[model samples]
Target: MFECFLEIAFEAEVLTEEHPELQELARQLVHEDPATRPAAIQELRDMIYERGECAPRRMDDAFLLRFLRARRFVVPRAHKQLVRYCRFLEQYPELYRDVDLWGLARVGCAYEGCMLDRPGVGRVTILRFGTWNPDDYPVEELVKVGMAMMEIGLRSPKMQVLGGTVIVDMAGITMKHVATLTPTIAYQIVCLMGLAIPCVMHSCHIVNYNWLLNTFFFLFKRFIPKKAWKMIHFHGHDLESLHQLVDPECLPPRYGGTCRHHATIGTWFNKIRKYRDESFDRDMKEFGWVIKE
Candidate 1:
């Protein structure tokens, strides 16, 4: 009975409450108190109904939990975040138009690894942003693809409680790629990550960067908050530095690691597709993702 217009779902295996370990993590990280959880959710629901502005398609516990956990069970902050999320989707119709996995994968630049299961690590997302060619896929499409991946990751309760770690591979970036990220685009992306999205960003590791990439990051740095700025760690081709923060055993060989289970666009697409709900397509149609048969 999860009626999410956002079209995101928790992973199938971990969807149930059978895993007490994750439930404990939720209590520790997100302050999910068993006694007060019901009251908080009801307060959020009442706030949403009172405002009636940009409310989600459904206000079920499952959907509201994402926001609640993100805001550390603060009813008012969660409600505000929910509104911001809904408004972001409504405002950016053009960016999400025709955003499909098959079409985006065909661009040959959306490289992402799997959600790592190492005990100490959260969900690690490896985004090879430098490999993207602006000619093939514009910045708007890049945002669309990144947003899609994040939306998929949000379905995991583990991802919500444990939060996320991002590695931005800046190996093949050029002025052409940097120039494509206009100030407007940078501002919008910053806002999406900072406000609209409910996911907790634990850390962001940037590898293989150069002066060109530094210039590129400067565009986004001004838009980023002081607290969020501290989360970004820059490593210009120094994999060892990245290893100190992110476990080297979890990374792939190209990033100076020993793991080979990294996900290509096609493999990751198929893997998540297996766990995707039947209603995903119907719910995502508004974002212009029509599955071609």
Candidate 2:
């Protein structure tokens, strides 16, 4: 059951990036045929409810106890990236200590938009953490990836470019309000899709991607108009968590309602060994983080 949830979560993340509109479609599908879609939706809702109530200390522990006896391994590319990133951190610990790996990756995505070097391709804004040091992560690598993505966006005639950077302190915000403020803050910082600007929040730590994404999606789908375009807040939580949380069912399954899916316990643990070791290796090799031998 947990494994199923993880699969659903992963699918959601992939769909969010590849076909965001599918989220809306999925919701509509549920509404269009409650008998089928709602069943799936209920499954997701049940899972989160249990998760919140149980509050497993770590996703890995939950996975190990509930799923397969052993855990899975990491993909080669992810391994390489993890090793490289770690090496960079070790080489420049002072700068990278507080730098969020996930945040850097997300910033890399935004940078992609800027590099497109096209007209009206949208803006790239960085919300500054007053105390953060750029040296922590591979800022150069981030700049490189951001530029590459931007170049891709520029090639598209339909997408224009408007770019800038914004730095703001995020110390006072409550966890509950994080989702609501994310897009609102982005809109304040940059000129997004003309309806509601698209923005990503680069934060150091987050409680749970499922909870956060669920909250953001609910608010986004409900209050924001149909024409408005805004991405849910992005904190570089574990990639696996992001994958798990992206499911349409993870949200309230229906707009003004609660979820009904059963929590997939121990599913994440099945892949922890692979994710951790591979992530470490990828950080060291690809991002140049130092490996502690």
Candidate 3:
């Protein structure tokens, strides 16, 4: 996640530096009367390219690493919100694990007035949300929201999803028929995407004799992919309140090679563990993971 954030920060900075004129044009559009800005910006782009100006420089990995290191001491306010949200998840594992934690983080960060509103930072924020909950919402909704947020972050931009199929129908379809056929069609569609539905189990965690964890686990299991289930890193005081997902003795047999850590995101966490020592420790402490430093 940190690496992804750094990449976006560098991209934003590089784009701005390479295209100062474009950036100014975008600013002008924002300041102009709404009706004229769109066309004026288009005209500006054409005029610039016609003059044989060099294309903007693309963001590279080294630049991003440097930017992140430079900004290391000045943690974004949004990051603080993210840490708080992660701590919340640790405390109430059942309530937050499957509840769009990244979405909650993004909203929390936005509300907290983070510099993430700046170009590259904003893209990093979106990408983090995407990684945390790739399938939390419908694809259509994700595309719509993601595009809007990207526009806000990348100032002068066009979003295009290449090499993907899109089907558009203008025919007026009745709501009842569309609703009736949607699930069946959606099920069929998954086969085309080369995916298989995995087995899911309904389990619960009991915290303080309360069934909150169990209830949340049920909902989370429904929304998230089975393979990514272990991304929820539990912490906090009420271990007894939480429910175990699977019995150690009853572990499922794997047909192929498998690691002890099954989830991809969990694997990523392990890979970046060294780089995130401070952030990880701070998060752990905040979430009641009482470890002696």
State which candidate has the highest TM-score. 1
Overall local distance difference test of candidate 3:
0.27
Candidate 2 wrong stretches, greater than 4 Å: 3-248, 252-283
Tens-digit lDDT track for model 1 on 46-87? 999888877586678877888998898988989888998888
Clashes of 3: 4
- Candidate number with the higher TM-score (1 or 2): 1
Q: Give one digit per residue, the lDDT tens place, for model 3 in 164-265.
A: 111111122233223332332333223221121111112211212222334323433444445534433332333322214322222212211111222222
lDDT of 2 at 267: 27
Between candidates 2 and 3, the lDDT winner: 2
Question: Predictions ranked by TM-score, top down?
Answer: 1, 2, 3
- Pick out the ten consecutive residues of candidate 2 with the lowest summed lDDT: 64-73
TM-scores across all candidates? 0.85, 0.20, 0.19
The true-structure Cα RMSD of candidate 1 reads 5.5
Error of 2 at 237 (Å): 23
Clashes of each: 2, 68, 4
Error of 3 at 110 (Å): 6.0
Q: What pairs collide in candidate 1?
A: 9-155, 10-155
Per residue, candidate 2 scores C-alpha lDDT tens digits across 1-293 of 85576455323311112244433432332122223433333443345355443332223321211111000111222223223333433433333333333333433212211111111112222222312334454334333233222222222212211222221223333353343345433332222212212111221113223434454344334444443323333444343443243332222222121233322112222222223344344533343333332
